[model samples]
Target: MDIKNVFQAKDVPEAINLLDQYGEAAKVIAGGTDIIIALRENHVKVSVLVDISSIKELKEIKTSDDWVEMGAAVTFTEVMDYFKGHKEYSGLIEAASLVGSPQIRNAATIGGNICNASPAADFVPPLLALDAVLTVEGKEGKREVRLEDFLLDKGRVDLNKGELLTTIKFIRLRKGQTVTFSKLGLRKALAISRLSTAVYLEIDDDEKCAEVRVASGSIGKHGLRERVAEESLKGKNLDKAAIDEASKVLSNEVEKRLAGRSSCEFKKDAVEGIFLKAVEKAMVHNGDGSYCAMGTQYYPRAAGKE
Candidate 1:
């Protein structure tokens, strides 16, 4: 498990060249967050280490007409700094702020998070909820993959030999759109998650839900969207009864995948509580329930009040 070779690239072109030379025997290290973890566990063996942390092009944040494109090497700390004031990315900004600690956040990049492909990766649920896509470049050239398709299993992605994650793209949240992210890790600080959920919805003038996205992690080997629960909640009225029914759907979907886990019974109750709180918090601006005590006008799903 020794890292016998280490090569640092000054830019993306150099990085790509190094990867091309080493091919499958190579692995890119940006933040070194996941790579270090795997190396410590003796789970990953990369003969050629191409360090991409020095690459300038893969560390930018750009916004287009419909989306915000995040460079592969942009750290979680950088995301927090850049998106704190951005109107469209409140949910993502908050999620980034919650990753690891100050040191870990300073070193963990979004691409590394996605490419690491951990089922309980804290960032994946919110990104999937935003319907995010990925751009990957390899010797054959570049191609885009939907995040759902890119992550097929634990520690698995569609990235080919000599390929590098280039960017992540997602539409900017618009007016009337609200999103919530929740996670239950073993501890509050520096913990891997046990279960997590992301809820994003756009509400119409008639108080009905539109474009609802619900995804979860730690229920299986990969972070996946629950299509059954999402489809069931789409176009439904935003009311007490509908919210309760939607939570029921979510609980069952989670139950279907919770067998043999260390915390199925606890997850069964926590999942329902978390989803209901997410929906209720998202609807607070709609004038239905008491505001959460967090002193922020925004919905706080972890508080779990209706």
Candidate 2:
């Protein structure tokens, strides 16, 4: 890797100033799990690496009465720890746990996972399902954008020169609402996701699907919302039949999007099962018509436990 300077930023303003000064040659480095590899492989050319990993403001995870705000430099391990037993945020925890491996999770920031914009990033689909919003800062000012809109294409986001993603914010999950994630990989541990799905479900008092969001990974140019599948489930009782129909809808959509790709044939069929798993994981019910059970397991392997 060819590099000229390294700046250790103390705060968001300092990082923004360094990036503005260095322009396109400067790249933010948090965790360095992804950027370091990119630099080594010549995938990216950088003259400056602004280390924001130690910035206090960038490592915060704050929650309000109705929302949660996480700094861009917050690591996956931190995410998992903060939301560990919170059933409503189980999907977010599961996704964080499933990233690369324990070491990678400790060193991999959610912001980096997001900024890297990998098609198979474990944390993205769950965040998308939550309709998360991003707060970006630059020399000019700060601006917010929906996560769905911020993602443009494979390995791309709407981030501009001199701008740094500050925090990701989303509404807190409440009664009757839960998010769940499921994925397929070559092996249980240390394998990148081959396909994944996240479901944000809201079942009303009548046991009908009130609102549902389905997001997918490794099935498109980037993580995407499966609106057709969501539409099929809304207003319907979440019976096996309803879920199966939604799964079929997702299967069809995957076939359409991945039409000419070599993995299309397999993914189209496989997505149905994966989507169902995520939906089922979020469907735990209670007598008060609320989602009461956190249908996720804490994987010891992900926690670096033998």
Candidate 3:
């Protein structure tokens, strides 16, 4: 596909107008990360490039009221900077810092990451664990959907033809809650994740599991919640054995779904470690639990090794 025209939209309304005028052949480009790749590979048949990167409303990161809302254009770099002094959001902030190295993170938008719907998208798992909500604007008006549902499958989303992702909002975790993010990229940097996991567990003062959510990526066709695993830890005691069982359920769940995928076995093993680590971290931060008490040992391998 040849680049015939590039349309720059000043705001969400203008962007929607471009989409309406261009119809199916129009493609929206924000950071140009995915669209550029698509254009190079001839994967898209786009005539009008509706660039929304200049939209001011989509670039701000606002935290107030009941949720922390991010504009669709918020970059990974922005996310990391937004949470620098905040500890409760450390997990998601860390995930943002770890995604796609410095350049890619600087250019990649959080909305693009969600809309691209990659199974191994680094931030999807964390936002899922956060139980995020996305507000989308269309010709009719706006609609809000849970992040888990908005991101349905790989290379797919729930957006309508002219619906532009506007804002992403989620509850800001309270001061004693625990949240953690982990990923299993093949390398430390410049590598797509082979798998990733994020856990947010709110352990009460009595040391009982109050609220727990687990999400995984790259272990299936799309990142999804470990429902069975979440159910297993509900209202349970904070102990090594209980955490072990929940971790086992998560591993088994992913293995069941991505069974024949080439990376299933590797991801299964990786999930065990990631899940255990996330839970251990959460417990230590919020519960009266310790990694040493979890009866696990992690030996540092040689360089260029696991």
- Winner by lDDT: 2
Candidate 3 ranges with C-alpha deviation above 4 Å: 285-306
* Tens-digit lDDT track of model 2 for 46-131: 99999999999989999999999999999999999999888888899999998888999999999998999999988999999999
| lDDT per residue as tens, model 3, 45-148 | 77788888889999999988678899999999999998896666767887898888799999999998888888888888888999999999988898999998
Task: Tell me the whole-model lDDT of each prediction, alpha carbons only.
Answer: 0.78, 0.88, 0.80
Among residues 3 or more apart in sequence or in different chains, the pairs in candidate 2 whose N, CA or C atoms overlap within 3 Å are none
lDDT of 1 by residue, 106-174 (tens): 999999998999888878888898889999987778899989899978999998888899899888766
The lowest-lDDT stretch of 10 consecutive residues in candidate 1 is 290-299
Candidate 2 C-alpha error for residue 269, in Å: 1.4
TM-score, one value per model? 0.90, 0.93, 0.91
lDDT of 1: 0.78
Q: Tell me, by TM-score, which candidate is best.
A: 2
Better of 2 and 3 by lDDT: 2
After TM-score superposition, the amount by which residue 52's alpha carbon in candidate 3 deviates from its true location, in angstroms, is 1.2
